[model samples]
Target: MPVDFGPPRVDPFEQAIELGAGRVRRLRSVPSGPAAPAPVQVRLPRQRAGNCTTAPVRRRPVRRPGVPSAAVASEVARRVSDRRPAPRLRLTRRGRALVRTVVLVALAIAAIAIAVSSRADDVTPVSSRSMVVTEHDTLWTIAEEASPSRPRSETMAKIRELNHMPDATVHVGQRLLLPAP
Candidate 1:
């Protein structure tokens, strides 16, 4: 191997200028005075070699066998920026389970809230009247007398449920709350 002590790589612009390849011309004259800052005269190439068009040349990305160009560009950008991809929101099994549980709880709470609100809208004030049990007054007799138009079985069930009576038996002089007639 030859010992190389020069710059690691040659500048393409300087190489072009030395080779007189593009017929580069200065756009403006450089100022020689110290009053203002040094003027940077940009020398633009007249025409690219082997191409006659003045329009900018667009370079196509090299296509690898199985790799896509977009992926390559994204990788290049990431490397150039010296930043790791925003740590992919990776979830472990426990993390996924926690997230799922939270979602389920939220859904359950929402469902409960909806059900409660809907039930609230349907609720009306129930006005109940009290009746004292007599010797002849049984549950069936009271239900029949209170709501004669309604079914006896339904009225009796409601009365038993209201009084928390496991069996259809009422002591004499016992106070009972009857549903609306």
Candidate 2:
């Protein structure tokens, strides 16, 4: 047997009876002898486009014997209007680029501000006294005279650093800068 990939065919008579094609269900009311109210048409919901098979139709609840029709109609209206579609945000390509550029600029400005705010402000003051080398004056004697309370080695290193001297060699009449006492 060949395989079939289509919806099963439904019998027309059975489908009609299932949809209550010839039926008129009336709400219970005082019966008038000669004339009866016209039957209300039951409209089935429309199927989506391109749909091949029929979907099940939902039936409305049967009104109770003593309930008023107006109340039922109001309840249905409230339910139908309860929910609404949420608002959506749609950005075009140019809008997205503009937002990206704004964010990058903001980041750059923030970085620059942080860099400017966090800077070093404590600068060591330059204060020194100049001295002329004399005959028989050695670096040790000069260090001892410059800082009597400090270590001789520390004072000697500081003197050498202040004068940019590589060693303890000094000539007579040569001028040298000494660190503050």
Candidate 3:
């Protein structure tokens, strides 16, 4: 027996008549055994409900009058007008002199403190005559060597008076008389 493998016969005349009469056509002969065809798969298009674009529409920027511009000008004026009278810096001549005197005294005290601190490391105390007037010796150096224990301001004053120095300038090779301790 030869096997028959072909598409099942569909009656087009009967399908047309059934469709015209608005009736369903039932399959009369279904293939059996190995000759039966596999079921076909179909894909249908998906149906959308409404509008698909979900992004919001862009709007024009809003403009307000006398608000942003005045805010900037007011901020500038606020910073400009913040001069708080500069603390009324009224110093009389007496007060100015007092401040100058205090500053001078503080400078003198600091110079003395630096001199003492520098000499604190040296164990031996240098006598007044140990300092020699060399070509490169300055009045400040001479004072420092002569009276290392004394404040620099006092030593400088003593050296100035002893050497009869009109100003702070001292020439090289000039022998200066060291004051007594």
Candidate 4:
């Protein structure tokens, strides 16, 4: 049998009925009856583009008696007068070079810090203690209990070095050397 993966075909008549295509809605403008008045025409003075000589119209200040209105109006005027176009963000060649240099320097410093810290961590003296494994005891649990302050992996490695174990296997009641925190 052939299987179709695309959407099922829809009936055109059903789609049209669902979309209300069969319903005809007729709406007419409000009938202009005798109650409506006719519009009148008025002519306005036109100004020429090049030959314009009229002075620009100015708004008169609203004479408010209180200090608040005067202060608000003055502040609005000051803000409008002091308004300026914002500076666009465009980096110069020198700025781009400086950012690149800073990033490279930071990466170099991070690499050096990682190297120095790894060497520093290796130089630390490790203390060991002998502990007997009990029933249901694993190397991870032993490592965690032994060195609670340091990483479990580091403590496990230290325990393995102290006990000379090949893998992370230990027998119950077996004597093993563990690392101290």
lDDT of each: 0.73, 0.71, 0.63, 0.71
**Cα miss at 48, model 1 (Å)?**
78
TM-scores for all predictions: 0.34, 0.33, 0.27, 0.30
Better of 1 and 2 by lDDT: 1
Best by lDDT: 1
Per-residue lDDT over 1-181 for candidate 3, one digit per residue giving the tens place of the 0 to 100 score: 9765543344432221122223433433455556555433222222243753444322333457755665578998998999676777889999999999999999999999999988897744433553446777777877778778998779888777766789877776566767777
Which residue pairs come into collision in candidate 3? none
**Which 10-residue span in candidate 2 carries the lowest summed lDDT?**
10-19
Pairs that collide in candidate 4 are none
The residue-by-residue lDDT of candidate 1 on 1-181, one tens digit each, is 9887544353223322212444434333444556544334334344456777556543444577877688678999888899657777989999999999999999999999999999999975454787999988889999998899999999898888778899899999998888788
Residue-by-residue lDDT tens digits, candidate 4, 43-74: 22343557777763223445656556766889
Q: In model 1, which regions exceed 4 Å deviation?
A: 1-125
Q: Per-residue alpha-carbon lDDT of model 2 for 57-132, expressed as tens digits?
A: 4445477787768867899999889978877988999999999999999999999887776653343344467789
lDDT of 4 at 102: 99
| Candidate scoring better on TM-score of 3 and 4 | 4
- Candidate 3's C-alpha runs over 4 A off are 1-132
